[model samples]
Target: MVLVYGHRGAMGYAPENTIPSFRLALEMGVDGVELDVHMTRDGEVVVIHDFTVDRTTNGHGYVKDLALSEVRRLRVKHGFGGKWGPVGVPTLEEVFREFGGRTRFKIEIKRGGDYYPGIERKVVDLIRRYGVNAQVVSFDFDAIRTVRELDPNIETGIIFIGRIRWFLDIARKLRVRWLHVSQDLVDPEGIEEAHRSGFLVGVWTVNDGEVARRLVSMGVDDITTNYPDIIIKAIRGA
Candidate 1:
């Protein structure tokens, strides 16, 4: 059976990457929760999707620029019309403490504008400390490679947005267990190729039931979606 992962912790129900969002995902019975992490100025690992807080929170600055204390003061802007709420940005430590043992965590190391030096070490250390079933994933191949170098036992994956001819070749080089691809780019043929090469396939941000069923039929190992309940039902009914 395909595992259901809540994309940004049931982002459709609550603000992305907050405690309430993650709690809702667990309540909905998701097999795993996916979240993004960036290092704050205070050298703390905080969960938030974008490199900056302008999009998701009431504050207006880059996450790397702000200290965790400043970040904590901002409330998540939920839904349309910029509604303020109780949910704030959560630290990675807090996430691991609260829901580490409850579910699997797919932690994406955010590497957009400013690179967080030594982030892999910090993330891997936290995963080990929490003893949670977790995997570190990144669009940056070097970051994934760094994770492998730091600890070969820790599961690592590479995320890609579009097609790549050397996909499996690169994955083999990186020695990664998973290949996380965009839902639009995934196909049965590609899935088969990856599995044949001993790589598990995970498709991200899928929300449609029909699409979820199709991916399941194609033999995807993991389906990351905003609505895990919908996707779980679709897979079960299929």
Candidate 2:
């Protein structure tokens, strides 16, 4: 199967990274869920894409400064006509406990600029504990390196955007097997270059059928989307 991942747990369908979004993705049969995580002030790893909860929640402040209790108390914002529920910020451990073996993950660890040290180690431990390798994503090579050190078999993709060779060179040097790129920024040349070098190519935030079809024609292996239904439909010619 050409793997289809739910970007932020179907961001288009429900609040990003909430249980509702995750449930929708699983219902749609997505191969994996791509979520971003940040360390709270008290050291709990919470799942959220943005560095702060201000945009998505009815709260203000950087995510790193808030404790887990504060974050969980925050409510996720649902757009007009969308259902607003208390899909409180969930802990990575809680997410794993709920969906661990049942679903795959592409865990993106946010960089907090030294506000939190050893977070990479803790996040790596959670992935290791779940025993779901081939289930994490990050732009930080350090996170990937730490995860690799703990368990060399876990699949970790170094995320990059904009230029092709910019990431290709690093991937080659770091032994990164996957190049997770932004759908709009990636060109056929980039995909070809990565593929030629024996690396798997994946694109993110893709929701349109035409673009999805075009990328598949170009040999991209994964398509991460806020609309898993749309992507899966496009891929299956439904």
Candidate 3:
């Protein structure tokens, strides 16, 4: 059976990566939840998609420059408006404490331009501390490699946007067990080859019922969707 992962904790229903959002995902009975993490100025790991809080929250400025106190003060914006309310940015520790052993987690490390130094180590430490079934994934090859170097026992995956000629070979070189591919780039032939090579496949941001059914039939290991309930229903109906 294919696993269903809630993308940013049912982002379609609640603010992405907030406590309420994650709780809703758990309520939906999703197999797992995927969230993005970035380092705050105080060296704290907070859950939010972008490097800056401008798009998702009422705050302005880069996350890397904001202390945890300032970050917590900012309220998350609801649905493309300036309506900032109660939901604040959550820390990695808070998330672990809330849902840690209850479900699986695919933590995407958001890196590039002012990326957090030693974030992989911090993330690995928390995962180990919580003992949650989780995987660290990043588009940055070095980030994934850093995870392996720090703790080979920790699972890691690579996220890619477009097609690559030797994707599996790259995965093997990196010693990653899963590939988080973009939905448009997924092909049955590629998925079959990946499975045959002992690699798991996960597609992201998939929300349509027909597309969900098609991917499930193609034998994807996990489908990360914003609407976990919808995807679960679609998969069951299939």
TM-score of each model, paired residue for residue: 0.95, 0.93, 0.95
**Per the 3 Å backbone cut-off, how many clashing residue pairs does candidate 2 have?**
1
Off by over 4 Å in 3: 80-85, 112-114
The root-mean-square deviation over C-alpha atoms between each candidate and the true structure, in angstroms, is 2.1, 1.8, 2.2
lDDT of each: 0.89, 0.81, 0.89
> Residue by residue across 135-171, what tens digits does model 1's lDDT show?
9999988888988998999999999976533598999
Candidate 2: tens digits of C-alpha lDDT, residues 115-167: 56777778878877877633556777777666666666667788886756678
Looking at model 3, the pairs that clash are: none
> Would you give me the overall lDDT of model 2?
0.81
Number of clashes recorded per candidate:
0, 1, 0
The residue ranges of model 2 lying beyond 4 angstroms of the native Cα positions read: 80-84
How well is each residue in 89-149 modelled by candidate 3, as lDDT tens digits? 9999999999889999999998832379878889989999999999999998889988899
Decide which is better by lDDT, 2 or 3. 3
